[model samples]
Target: MGDTNIVGGIVKILETPEHKTFSANISVTKFRVQFPQFRNTSVVHLTFWGNLARYVADFYKINDYILIEGYISLRTKRISSKVISKSKKIEITVFKVYPLLLS
Candidate 1:
């Protein structure tokens, strides 16, 4: 079993989902979702492959609260320019998303 189940409001939609085709004609859609914490908020980059990608892109909108169940992983990237820099990122690989409606 994995160690991640997150429930939060969608504070911002970083980018609209876009479809990309890779080797073997494998297709994927990627987007970002922000979850506000008590004092600080965390952003999660998400990728949905194939049908789920299309469904989420069409069905979900900004500011919609959602419950996400998935696994968490850390991503690191190097930024190079005048000075070399390293950036660390946290992302959730979403298995399921449940829309939350508040009364």
Candidate 2:
């Protein structure tokens, strides 16, 4: 099991949550929450899965301040094909969430 981490920030962009079905008809809810950084205000994407995903999607809206508890992962993807460059994209999978400062 990976270590649990928590992050709190104002909701930058609250995209619509979606329901997806995998093999064997296993269903899961997925959503991305983009929050800003402290200094530069760069956005970070947080993923929510399962029941918590539904709750977050139903309750939270843009500009709402929320605290997220989850696991962090780095995804390496090719950023430029001509330049042969790769970049690490930071992703957080949220397991639990707390309402810090609702708006």
Candidate 3:
């Protein structure tokens, strides 16, 4: 097994018809874990893979609290802008996710 970077935060699962091929886009809102010098709320995007992918997608729901443990992956996707040109962005890929109790 490889060493994975863990990021924990609130779950924000996004589902779109186009993403039916693999799995729904999973995201974490207000991700506070970051570098020592950086203090900001960030969003983390996670892509489930293989058999475990379905489990994570099915079990987790929007607004659920979760702790994700996985390697940090950087992805660049093109986005359309109204007044600006094309843009590329980065995201995180989660391999493991666990639900946390509110209490």
Candidate 4:
């Protein structure tokens, strides 16, 4: 468990939500959201699963502002083969989402 809640605009829907069936036909939907940092305008990544993923895919689009409640996770992935380099990324797993209506 982590303490992380984020409010930002949707920069890009990296991938549309899709349902995948695992062993025994257990299903889940997953998608990604990109937002910007408040202070420096840097980008952040978010992942939504199950119902939240479906909702986000149906209602959200690029450049839409939204408030998300979730936990942050630090992920490390191998990015290079020649040099054996790795990259660290921060991702948020969303539990709730709200569209920010602007007038």
Candidate 5:
């Protein structure tokens, strides 16, 4: 399979705690970008896994702007009551975060 990659704006940040391990959530900002020929402003979500919690946390504030390049995916699991819930998640194994550059 070809490598999956996406470049978009960072929207929201979500953090969850499970016993000891932690997870991260980065919501995509609303903007239009060219994906070959299709342009879209739809918001995309990205999740940082494992030890990336701290790094992703410091990258964004309430309304900070950022650009993330990584893979896109979804995750589903059964909770305590055995209820299966789905989450829009991304591995985000490798990403480049860029802040504003003033010239």
Candidate 6:
């Protein structure tokens, strides 16, 4: 991966990994992480694909402090179903996961 970013934080949400077969089998996992910046909390959504997805689904849990190495991109999300408001969120396509501190 080029221009990869490394992020470290606590896992706030761990959604179940989705494993599906297309022409071939593929696995994807999504989760949220909360990191402290100054006095406030910042959150990021992480996407894990391939073999890492299976490893994460089996090993990681909430409150785990892990380092993510991947590419960062911004995405637009609807604030609410009834509202017209939209917000931009930072998302990372994780390539490698390091369980530096397990809780």
Per-residue CA lDDT of model 4 for 1-103, tens digit only, reads: 9565554344444454555656854445555555654434444567776666666666766556677777777676544543334766667777777777422
Residue pairs in collision within model 6: none
RMSD of 2: 4.2
lDDT of each: 0.63, 0.63, 0.48, 0.59, 0.41, 0.69
How does residue 34 of candidate 1 score in lDDT? 74
Question: Which one wins on lDDT?
Answer: 6
Q: TM-score: which is higher, 5 or 6? A: 6
Give the TM-score comparing model 6 with the true structure, all chains together: 0.71
lDDT of 2 at 72: 75
Q: Candidate 3: lDDT of 102?
A: 24
Model 6 spans with C-alpha error above 4 angstroms: 1-23, 37-39, 79-86
Question: What does candidate 5's lDDT look like per residue over 12-42, in tens digits?
Answer: 3232211124244432322212222233433
The lDDT, on a scale of 0 to 1, for candidate 5 is 0.41
Q: Per-residue lDDT tens digits of candidate 1, residues 1-103?
A: 8665553343345556666877876667767777655334567777666666667777766566566666667777545643335676766666676676422
| Candidate 5 ranges beyond 4 A from true positions | 2-5, 10-45, 49-55, 81-94, 100-103
Candidate 6 structure lDDT:
0.69
Prediction-by-prediction clash tally: 0, 0, 0, 0, 2, 0
For each candidate in turn, give its C-alpha RMSD to the true structure in angstroms: 4.6, 4.2, 7.3, 4.8, 8.3, 4.1
How much lDDT does candidate 4 score? Answer: 0.59
On residues 2-54, what C-alpha lDDT tens digit does candidate 2 reach at each position? Answer: 66555544455455556565686545555555555554445556777666766
